[model samples]
Target chain A: MFSELLGIAIIFGATVLLAIPLGLYLATVYRGDKSWSDFLAPLERLLFRAGGIDARRGMSWQQHLMALLTINLVWFLFAMLILCTQGVLPLNPDANPSMSPDLAFNTAISFLVNCNLQHYSGESGLSYLSQVVVIMFLQFVSAATGMAACVVVFNALKEGTNEKLGNFYDYFVKSLTRVLLPIALLVALVLVFQGTPMTFAGKQPLITLQGDTTAVSRGPVAAMVAIKELGTNGGGFFGANSAHPLENPTYLTNMVENFALVLIPIAMVFALGFYLKRRRLSYMVFGVMTAGFLLLLAPTVYYEMQGNPAIAQMGTDMQLGAMEGKEIRLGAAASAYWGITNTIISCGSVNSMHDSHMPISGMSEMLGMMTNAFYGGVGVGFLNFFVFVIIAVFISGLMVGRTPELLGKKIEAREMKIAIIVALLHPLMILGGTAMAAHLYVSNPTEYAGWLANPGYHGFSEMLYEYTSAAANNGSGFEGLGDNTPFWNISTGVVLLLSRFLPVIGPVAIAGLLARKKYTPESAGTLRVDTATFGLMVFFVIWIIAALAFFPALALGPLAEHFSLY
Target chain B: MKNNFASAFRLTLALLVLCCGVYPALVWGAALLAPGQGQGVQVSHKGRLVGFENVGQKFDWPEYFNSRPSAVGYAADGSGGSNKGPSNPEYLAEVNTHVAAFRQQNPSVKPGQVPVEMVTASGSGLDPHLSPAGAYAQVERVARLRGLPAERVRALVDARVQQPIFVLLGPSKVNVLQLNLALDSLSGR
Candidate 1:
């Protein structure tokens, strides 16, 4: 327990230690690079004149986000092209060819949107040409696009005229060349140390198996996993995914991979809170997310630690954690840890199966998915969390007869409506999807229910949770449900599309509105969002929203699983 | 708050550049100057350095201890499944394939038993290191077929297993590729 406590403290300490430096750097970049601007001035003017847009004026937040969305849309089309024609491309080892449209769209929207929810394994489905030209390259720039959005918004929020949100292209390029590419390379090297396969070779030596010598598949996976995780993109290079020894070579490597998955998402809030000069504000976001994150983590760890008693009946002696749907070396601690971290960060990679977790553990993972999407990542989570804070603060402000303000800007009617919609989207998706799954389709029953593994209500709950995870861009699965089927694929795809765009619109709207507002300097009576008080307030708001929407769904699934197993 | 917030964000962005860009350039340069490896980006073989042997796809020939339980990684380019469980219908079927294969390779061996790790794949399906027990279990069969003594084979295993930082962090294991290479020389294959 002391060690665990110490581990938690160390984790938090590292987060803050790294965040302070990182946050300060982000602050500087957002203030704009005058030297670079001067150098690019002529080109910017030329391009703007050619493109028939005003070069001198700053883009409104709406206009800026629109540009981002438009680029993303185009990127989606480009990614789809690679996926569709992958089979015909050279460097095709498998002779495997062209992706199905649905799969192609899911993957394209995934990477282009930076969600990277993969339905296809890389080594087989994609040719080397497809892998390099499409996935790897998209990874570099798509990552930049997301980071640039936040940087632009951060600048707009701070800049005096409420005019210059900064140039989109410059920020995107810098984010790619300066941030994503370099970090990805370093991480890739570290991953190689952790035993990720780094090769363009045909395959490793063949071991004779089943009277046949099977040639193994090999490609540039180490490089990809490095960027995929760092960029918070969750697509796996192969089907066995991260648990593959090559993907995660050792337990130490596993820990590092998990660390890679989350380091940025947690760090970003400090980036936001600190750069805003409300150290307390960043602290508050930090505290709230930590509280929310840890709440989710504890139960997952406990349930995973509790493990499967049925396995215990065999006298095999499984550990006490949520052993179901998890790796033995990793155990429940690590699985639960990944579950919580992935959902919080809005990164969808899974090291363990979630569908098999004990009921309580499952809910906690769900709650992590629900994370009000707080400063969530490059695009979605943070904006969602900010909106939640807006409404929570706004509601409280109204009740107390004080104006609701977040980060020195008034949280007015439009912002509250947007937050409400964004906050409400998942519950609607979860409930609607669950209801449809239960009322309409019945999956071939899987055999492992202590409760969650069984049929009927628990089964319905599983469907709901799966949709919730998918919709949330939180890819941790219940594993009890077979979702590779068309119903799930289609439904998840639909939910994914809606979920992807909805939260985005809300944030862009909020940024636009906020961009239009003149600065309201802090006064003594104004609500302070930086202190522990604000932390608790934000924490309360997050809890209330999660409880209201998810409690029943969680109860039917993980809650029931817990009692039946116990 | 305004001023402070901007400063923190700037600091973060700068550090990101430093960590992501500058640090990597330094590492890449170091690799170039270093005595061995990864300088050209591929982990290659001794002679042609034709391709990187370091990662991906296990070559499952009879003599070598297979590296990982790959999904679609081998020649098929389509992922596969062992599909065995404590009670799977295909469980016995898959195990029999492993059992039969091992038995064929070691005609002197008994028929029914095989080590579990040789059959089961890790979650990632791309694991390169064999578990210690998995490697040790293969020693008797490998030694007998290659006409090498058990002690020598054990020595090879010991040589392949990576070293530890402390008692706990890393596990000792045989590198499947290196072990197989040594086995080939001994067998004159």
Candidate 2:
């Protein structure tokens, strides 16, 4: 127990320690100040020249969105084309077939939105060419897209009313050359040294000690797995994800991968502190996010370590605690810790099968995505939290009978409307999608019998989890859902698309509008957002809005399962 | 929009080369320094390749410590978990069946003494290690099957027990494959 606690503490402590320096470095890179990574400036210049992009040209908020969308559209089409014809492409040593059109649509949109909601298993579903060219490529660019958009918001938040923020291509290229590529390379090398396969070789046929012939899957997994966590893309190279021995290999590798999961998201918060010169405000945001993270994390770790009561009813020693869908090397505590981190950060990678977690733990996982703002995915996480901050600022301002002026910009009806819509959009899509799925399942049980792997409340959870994971732009799932069909693929694909862009547009628009407003200096009358009082207010607003909206849905799924089981 | 499209198209192509082509190739080059040349570390026994050192294989024979139940039947080519929710009746019944079978196989052990990991399936369907308690549970049955003393088998299990790194991270576990191979040498199989 002590070791398990220490294991999680070490992972969390190391991530925070690493995030601080990374945050400072991120601010430097985005600010275009000189640093150690300046050697990559030549490469960035070459790429910009090749693309005919003037890196010095500044962009308005609308221009930033346009560049982001156009590039994303191009990538989506490219991904679709490759996915549909991967069988004939090069590097398919296993000779996997092409995806059907619906699957291709789902997959392309999933990766493009930076939500790797894979309906198909990796080893069989994709050839090695698709794995590298489409999946891994999208993982890098999509995360950069989010980070670049975040920098736009950061520029807008600076103390000036200026139409010209910064060049979209500048932030985009620097995100790749400075932030993601260097870190990904470092992590990939570590994984390779730890024995994760980085070769182009296909599956190796082996004869077991028991004289049975079987084959082990191999690929350039080390490279893909690194960014899969680092960028918060969370697409696994194999069906079991990080649970696979070769993919993760050891406890040390698990720590590395887990550290990568939260590093950038947490760093972006500190980067906000440095970028905005609002260190107190950033610390308050970090504090609230950590408190919410631990709230969701504690129940999951406790429940997972308690062993499944249903299994405990049987005559067996469950000292290992709920080992059904967990690795022995990782143990239950670490897996529980990962479940919360992945869900909260919207990384959506799993080292354990969430479908088999104790009921309360499953609820905690869903709640993490439901809130979807606590240390969220890379750059987009803070954007999601930004909406909540706006809403909280407005609500608290109303209660105190004062105009909500955030960083000297007034929070008016227009900003409040956008914030509310963006906040409400999460629950609407999740609940609406799950309701539609539930209705479909209930109306004709026999027709969609294969949709669920388990019966009753747990079955409901599988459907709810899929939509929540999608709507949050989170890629993890309750794998028991037979979700590769046209119904699921198309529905979740639409959810992924809508959820990814609109939230981004709304936040950037609000920030842009506020940037154009007259900058009023701080005074005694201004409600200080950096104070502990305001932080608690924001925390309450998040729980009241995000958590309360999902309570009834919770009652029907994981909560129902918890009550019945325990 | 046209200007944006032109730049977007060019940038996308440029990034593909850098991200997919250059990056993975660099990692692959560095992997040459790793053990097994980054193809995965394989375990060989008596001049024959048995399996990967990290991937679990089936060992149903009475003389060997049986590996954990696998949802995919230990198929290394594909991996997955049972994904059975904790309260699913059918899944629970399956666990009970495993418990019953384990008790029947190891008759000297009490009904409640079986380690849960012995019955439950792992997430990867290829978990290579068992908790130290899981390995110790099978000592009696394996010793009886091999005509060896229980203490000798216990000592062998003890020798195979791998402590968590720095004794402060992860769980103490025994790799079933390595332990079984050591047992084979002990019994002169």
Candidate 3:
């Protein structure tokens, strides 16, 4: 218990310690104020020249959005094409078959959006060529995509009524080369050292002393895992994800991967502080996020360590903590910590199966993903949080009897409308999809009978967790959901597209709209967002919004599950 | 717009090389510098390789320390958990059966005293290590079967228990395969 507590503390401490400096560096990289990466400047310029991208040609927020959308469209098409044709492709030594059209669509969008909600098992579902070309490719770009979007927000925020935000092409390329690549490289080396396989070999057959022949699947796992964690793209090389020995391997690798999950998201938060030159405001945002994180973490760790009473009733002593669906090496406390952190950061790789967690622990995980803004995914996490920040600012503006202005720009009906729609859309997709699934589940039980692997309240939780994970752009599942069907694939594909883009559009649109407005100076009447009062307000706004939208769903799922267990 | 499209195309191809090709090659190169060369630490018995130390193998015999129960029957290929909720009836039944089997195997140990790790399937079906408590619980069975003193076996289990990384990263665990090999050496098998 002490070790688990200490491990969580160290992980959280290490993330902040590493992120602060990395955040500053990222800020400098985004601002382009200095040329520390001058060595790569020639290569960057060459690529720009090759593509006819004038480095100085700035984009309007609309143009930036267009570029972001267009590139994503291209990726979706490319990924879909490859996924549908990977059967005949080289490097498929295992001869893995092509994906069905619906699965391809789901997978393509899943990777393109950086959600990576895989419906198919990694070892069997994809060939090596597809894994390298599609999965690994999307992991890098999807992460870069998020960071690129945030760079747009940074540019818009930096300029006071300036018409030109930075070029999307420039930001996209630079984020990949300058920021994500180096860190992933270092992390990849560490994983490889700790025994994650990087070979291109297929599954090796092993004959145990017990005379059982098992075929072990091996691939370029180390490469994928490094970026998968670092980029906040949590697609597993295997179905069990980080729980697999080859994927995580050792305690050292587990720490490395967990640290990697929150690395960029936390760094991006600090980057916001440095970029805006308002360190205190950044700290305020960080504080609220930390509070939300701890709110989820405390219960998850406590209940997961408490062991399932129902199991104890069955005459099995659970004094060693909840061992079901958890590794003894990681133990219960660290596993609980991983669940919270993974959901909070939108890194869905699990060292422990969340499906077997205590009912309340599952609830905490689902709630964390639903909020989706407590130091969320790569660059998009803050963008998601910023939507609430707009709503909070507008509401506080009304409360304090002042005009709603953020960073000297007025928050009028247009900005408020977009923010509200995007913020509201998450619950709409989550609840609406869940309703459809639940209706289908009851009305046509046989057709979708196997859709949910568990029955009753836990079954409902599985369905709820699926949509929640998708809408939040988090890709972890209860694992018990037999979700590799057309219904799930297409349904979640649509949800993934909307949930991912709308938030990006809403946040960047607000930032862009604000950037074009004339700068207004701060006055005594201005509500200070950096103050503790406003931070608390933001915290309450997030909690209130989550509680209102999800409280009923919670009542049916983990909440009910928890009560029934007792 | 066309220029922007062209830029996007060119950049994608460029990054494909850098990220996909060059990056993986570089990582693979660095892995060679590390011990075991990313094939994992293989535990061998009498020169023939037994198994990877990091991966779990089935050890159901009373004379040996039992590894964690696997959901996939210790298949290293498709490693996973018994993705069952705590309240699921099937999971409870399975646990009950596992408890019965454990009681049958270690008759001297009380039902309540049997550690949960012995009955539950791990997240990775291939959980190579067991908690120190899990290992210690089986010490008596292993000691009696091998005609060794329980105190000596306890010392061996204690010695094989690995402290968490830097004493704060993970839990204390004993690699079941390594412990069993030590037993073989002690028994002069």
Candidate 4:
């Protein structure tokens, strides 16, 4: 028990340690006034001109909104072109084929929009060119888009009737050069040290036992694995995910991978408060988010350690702990920890299968998906955090009997309305999507799983999990759902599109409104977002949104399955 | 201006060197240092090496412990599963066939108590080891087929146990290929 707690703490601490300087750097970079290291300034300008993007085009809230949509659309097409045409590209000794159109558009838009919907495996499907251009390229762009949204909001907080949000060209460069690139390179090196494979060689051909020849999958996996975690994008190079011996070979490597997953999302909290010249506010947000994140973590360790009552009922030796879908080396600590981390930040990389996870353990993971997943999309976590901040601002204003003023802007009907939509966006997508998937697909309840195979509720939970995973962009499946079919493909794709954009527009509009208001002087009655009291409210509000949104539905899915097993 | 230009040139040159020279070479250095890591876990047949297996695979065949269920065909590039609901007739059929095959080959084992891994494929479908139970279940058959004592076969299983490379990485596991080759050495198969 102690060891598991220590393991969870190590992962959380390592992530927060990174948040400090990186957060400070992000804040200053987005502010765009300071000269970035004497050497990096001109190079930044050069990149803007090369992309055909205007360096001088500072945006209004309206323009910023359009730019996000336009940029995502353009990137979707770019990613699609690369995926469909990857067949003829280099690094194909066996001439690996191209993706079909439906998958191509789905994947391309998914990555560009930061959903990272990985329908194909990275080690085999992608050639060197597609890996670099389509997949890796989108990682950087998707990460930058999140940073770009935060900068717009940062400027909105500082706005005094100014049309300019911040510099988009500059945000792109700063995110790419300063934050995302350096961190990705660092984590990749660490993973290499911890034993993730990094090779450009073809699959090492070897004869199988029966004398049939087969080729092993190999590629530039280490580089992509690094960005996948740093950007909070958790697609695996191979289908075994981090469980593959090559992808995650050691205990240290497992720890490193888990750290890489949450590092950025946690750091963005500090980045928020620090960049806004409100360090306390970032800590406060971190504190609230951490409280909710930890609640999920606690039960995860407890239920898995309590051992599966089913294993006891069957009277089989389970000294190996929750042996279903978990590795002996990773043990319950990894299953519990990865579940907590994925839910906490929304990175969805799994060391063990979650569908086979104990019921309460699975519920905590689902709650994490519903509540924060902020480590939402890469820069998306911070964008989501800011939405919570606006809500905090409105509620505090009402408590003090004053107009809710955040970063000098009045929280009027427009901003509050947008915040409400952003807050509700997840519920509508997650709960509604789960209900629809449950009702439509999943008809054959009996003989669902040969082991967990029984008639009724357990199977229904599996159906609910499939849709929740899709709508939340969580990506980890129940392994029990037949999701590769066109029915799942189209529905999941549509849910992914709406969940991603609708929630995003709310923050964009709020940031725009905030940008127009001037900063006001703080008085005794004025609310300070950085205080401990306000922090508690933000935590409760986040919980309220999650509970109101998900608990009843959760009762239908993982929660019920958890009880039935016992 | 000239001095400023010289320093800027040097800085860019260093950045270029860092991106091109240091990064790629460092990664290469790390790869070579840990040749036994990740997909690098190869099964050697004397002087010749055969293949790699993830620690997650099952090994039930007396000649070899099978890898875990990897529904994704062994194409490392095409990582995925049958995505079949466990309730689906197809999945059940596959599981039952695995059970039938195991029962036919190893007659000594009690029915309905076959280790779970023997019956199901791993999610990746390319695992390379079996559970100790899985390896032990096959011990009797491999020994009888080779005309060796069952204790000796079990001893080989005990010997090949590679207490996980790191305890925190996964469950304590033994490599399937290593155990099989060692079994061959013992029985001179």
lDDT of 1 at A407: 59
Q: Please, what are the lDDT tens digits per residue for candidate 4 over residues B42-127?
A: 66666665666443332434455455556654555454444433233444566566667777777877764566555544444555
Evaluation by DockQ, superior candidate among 1 and 3 = 3
Q: Which residue window of length 10 is worst by lDDT in model 3 chain B?
A: B34-43
Q: For residues A68-126, could you state the per-residue lDDT of candidate 4 as single tens digits?
A: 66666656766687788889877665466898877776677666656555666666566
Between candidates 2 and 3, the lDDT winner: 2
Error of 1 at A1 (Å): 12
- Chain A TM-score for each of the predictions: 0.88, 0.99, 0.98, 0.91
Runs in model 2 with CA error above 4 Å? none
Alpha-carbon RMSD, candidate 3: 1.6
Residue range A1-566, candidate 1, lDDT tens digits: 22323333444466557656766656555555343324534543443343344433567666666666666655566678778987876767667779888777766766665665555666566776666656765666566676777666566556354755766655665565445665677677777655455545555444332233454555666667777777777666665456554555555656666666666666667668666665666776777777777777777676666555544333222322333333434434655666677767766677765544556766776777766464365545666676677777887787778888765777787877887988888788878887777656544233322213435445655676677776777555554465555566677778877887777767766876776687788798787766787667767777788666777777776666566656
lDDT of 2 by residue, A280-324 (tens): 989999999999999999999998888987777778887888898
Off by over 4 Å in 4: A1-5, A31-43, A52-58, A94-96, A121-128, A158-162, A193-195, A209-213, A442-455, B1-41, B53-58, B63-123, B127-171
Candidate 2 vs candidate 4, DockQ winner: 2
Query: Scored by Cα lDDT, where does model 4 land?
Result: 0.65
In terms of lDDT, the poorest run of 10 residues in model 1 chain B is B80-89
Clash count list over all predictions: 77, 0, 0, 34
TM-score of the A chain in candidate 1: the value is: 0.88
